[model samples]
Target: MTAQKKCPVCGKPAEIEFRPFCSKRCADVDLGRWFNESYVVPEPIDPETVIADDGEGDETIH
Candidate 1:
């Protein structure tokens, strides 16, 4: 049998509609965290990489 997933915000059993969260309130709370900058996605870029804008408004690696 598959184990039920718990809500990341409140540690409650996740509901089918919410999928990963228990309720709309929990979902909204998670969104609020993202808007408030509490959650961030990491982006790594190489400093040696150079991108130049072509005349046609497209970016090209020079």
Candidate 2:
């Protein structure tokens, strides 16, 4: 029995030539998006309260 692999982009079955990707077009599209920084993982941010320690603290040196 052969193991099945899913495409990294569309979650479809990956083709042998593309290995992790289903097709050359999909792989290229993903590469282009990554190069352009258009594909990003969504992160949640809170706008109300600000945390102090983001390296902008005023230090009093003796």
Using TM-score as the measure, the top candidate is 1
Pairs that clash in candidate 1: none
Worst 10 residues of 1 by lDDT: 46-55
* Best candidate according to lDDT: 1
Candidate 2: clashing pairs of residues: none
Q: Report the lDDT tens digits of candidate 1 across residue range 1-62.
A: 65799999999999989979999999999989888784454555655554443457645655
Clashes of 1: 0
Cα lDDT listed for each candidate = 0.81, 0.79
Query: How does candidate 1 fare on TM-score?
Result: 0.56
Point out where model 2 deviates above 4 Å.
Answer: 38-62
Global lDDT for candidate 1? 0.81
